[model samples]
Target: MISVVLPARNAAATLPAALDSLAGQTLDDFEVVIVDDGSDDGGATRAVAAAFSGRDSRFRLLSRPHRGIVAALEAGIAAARGWAIARMDADDLCHPDRLLRQARHLDANPAVGLVSCQVAFGGDARAAQGYQTHIDWCNSLTSYQAIRLGIFRESPLPHPSVLFRRELIDRHGGYRAGDFPEDYELWLRWLEAGVVMDKLPQTLLTWNDPPGRLSRVDSRYHTEAFFRIKAGYLARFLARINPCHPRVIVAGAGRITRRRAERLLDHGIVIEAWLDIDPDKVGKRVAGRPVLPWDAVPGPEACFVLPYVACRGATEEILDRLQSRGFVLGQNCLPAA
Candidate 1:
């Protein structure tokens, strides 16, 4: 059986929608565990209560003080009785077949310790904040490629989309709070411990993009903490993947990419070149590498592309062009150095 965990805090406005989606799921062999974090809005608790009122024994609610998301998720994980644990967010909605599909994938591929699926933007779909592009870019990655390309670093597997083995969490100890990012840290641990993770080729989750969310209310989600968390793991993984110091090429000569190039150069990885499609940046130099036009670069046999930003369309377009010229990604190319 599958156990679905939803950790909520002041999610009254969106909680009902989240629970409704789960209630409509085609798979009924799963249980719902909602951990209510200390919520001033009180919507989370109300939503949980409504979801369980006169319902079957499958739904369970656990309440706790506002000790942050890690603590809440820990409570839900501890209460979960199933061998497989799936994650759902307080505000996001799951597809009707999400659990069924994820469970089947895990059962069929025993080697996979965790699985996630494609997610589309909900709430407000017209926001030009790159949601459409993000969906397109995220869906392009295969299950193996997502895990191999340092998935946590280059736009994580989308936390709400994951359904992983409970044993994996027990062995590593469920989510921890503080300076480290929870999901990214867990993904790193899975990689370090050699736990395989896969992604299904279908969209199974809908991300609710609402105004005044925690990510926007509190800047923690967009802070330097995630960067540090990602960078540490990326360094360790890259060192393992390219022991001999592979030839590196960085795209987008921006501040972020320039800093990344500096970090690699400091670590003795030869910078093959810097690239940019902007005419103004085409002839400049950054971190001692000549900034060349995108098409001027040599093959990946002698270089790996490390684009700075997650400009999904631009990145994929460049990747396709480079890939067509016999560049195998992960082995020869990487994203966001």
Candidate 2:
């Protein structure tokens, strides 16, 4: 059986549609565990869940006080019965075959600890361009190695579209509560622990981008928090890959990128050089590191390269240059955002 964990908090506006989608799934061997995290919308959220539970025996609702998402998720996970724990949000809609496909993939590929799928973003037509770009970038990472290489660049998998083995979560101590995005932190932790993760190429979820989403309002998902998380994990990953404590070369000479790279210094990562295409910044020293031209970047035998630029097109160009120079991704070079 597959246990679907749906966390809700004042999600009355879109909870019904989400539950309805689950009810319409092609797979029948699944249970939905809805954790109502203190929704105060006149008990509307509870009413929705109650109605669904009455209609479908597989649906169950667990009401709790106003605890955060981490607590709600932990409660739901503890109550789950299936070996495979699938995640769902109160506002997202899953495709009819999402459960069947994901469960089958896990059954066939026992080595894969977690699997996510492509997502279709809904709401706000004006903001579609940015969301589309992100979706495209995420879809490009279809293999385990590709996902790991791009993990630090961004959240390579959509949280709501993922289905993972319960054992993996148990071994990692479950979701961690901190001053950073919980989903990203969990993925980073799993990667650090050598957990194999991959994403399906097909879009299996409709992700709603409402203005009041937690990511927009919560300080934990802020830009600085993401950078801090990335720097911490990147430093540890680099250290593990390079036992000799080789100097790290950061690509990009912008102030913002430099600021993010500087955070790595606090983690004991030595930033020995910076690679840039700009002639003005070349030969100059920034943050005690000399900014060198692209041709001057150290080879794989010397230092590890991290592409710190955020521009997607420019990042691809930088990656091409690194690859041409015989730098292997996830080894001597890793892309960063």
The number of clashing residue pairs in each candidate reads 0, 0
In candidate 1, what are the lDDT values of residues 23-103, reduced to their tens digit? 888998989988888777746465564567348577787877889888888888888899899999988999999999999
The residue pairs that clash in candidate 1, if any, are none
State TM-scores per candidate: 0.84, 0.95
Clashes of 2: 0
Tens digit per residue, CA lDDT, model 2, 223-267 = 788888888888888888763364788899899899988898888
Give residue 108's error in model 1 in angstroms: 2.3
Off by over 4 Å in 2: none
Tell me the whole-model lDDT of each prediction, alpha carbons only.
0.74, 0.88
TM-score, cand. 1: 0.84
Quote the lDDT for 71 in model 1. Answer: 85
Q: Name the candidate that leads on lDDT.
A: 2
- TM-score computed on alpha carbons, candidate 2: 0.95
